[model samples]
Target: MSLLHRIEHPRDALAWEGDMPTLGRYTAGIAGEKFFRAIQEHGQFLGTVCPICEIVYVPPRLYCEQCFEHLDEWIEISPIGWVHTFTLVHLDLDGNPLPEPLPLAFIQLDGADGGLVHFLDEIDPEQIFVGMPVEAVFKDPAERKGSILDIAYFRPV
Candidate 1:
């Protein structure tokens, strides 16, 4: 019988498979490195701005979906942003319940046309709101790993 057939919950089966490879640093692509590096090394959060539509894309991209054009301009975005949506995750991605819940949020950064999803810290769940002002918390420069996780999490400005 397949290993999945022995599992009770489909979610749990998937989590077990996902955790099979858990001991390595995953490399980000060039664009992703550029974005994370800006935040880690320079303490500057940046995004790709669509020159055609004039819309700033957070989670910086090399191409614009709307404009269908390559974006080469990197603009610094204000760390301040408003929380658009949020959720309190009681379990980790591996399906193991965490000792404490973590609150993740999609924040629409200031001066940008869209939002980025990341974890939020230093605030109570009940206090989180749709328009709460928050800022990115970057990892110490010397400890950076050129990954999105380099930004520890977002917190109240």
Candidate 2:
């Protein structure tokens, strides 16, 4: 069957519409798989080092973006990181006002070049600030599912 509809005039092409309801599955490529697996099983964070760039990638990648070199030097990095920036969320997913503000932050992982944007718990919203040190809280090993969610959230350390 032909997928394209014949269009004789430019204006006819403007009204085309189709429903492409997609159901898809995605795998975290090699590097991400390795990274999450470690987080799930060991409660440790892993990063791949790029010697040429003198950088470490957390939630590691298979190749370096700058030089396109394959990254193989894996290192265990501290799960503790400092908040690079943060926000207070006063509304829930359903748009209801929360009883208390939720703190979330972009945490720059210590000793690695990348970071994770995750929830910040166990701290007052007024006290959460840039550069506040925090650490991850992981689910019990038996409960982990090899995803970023394995780390329940980051909390003040």
Give the local distance difference test score of model 1: 0.84
TM-score of 2: 0.84
Clashing pairs in 1: none
TM-score of each: 0.76, 0.84
Report how far off residue 28 is in candidate 2 (Å). Answer: 0.9
Clashes of 2: 0
Which candidate number maximizes lDDT?
Answer: 2
**Residue-by-residue lDDT tens digits, candidate 2, 28-113:** 89999999989988999999999999989987999999999999999999989999999989999999999988888899999999
Among all candidates shown, the one with the greatest TM-score: 2
Once fitted onto the true fold, the runs of candidate 1 whose alpha carbons sit more than 4 angstroms away are 1-27
The residue pairs found clashing in candidate 2 are none
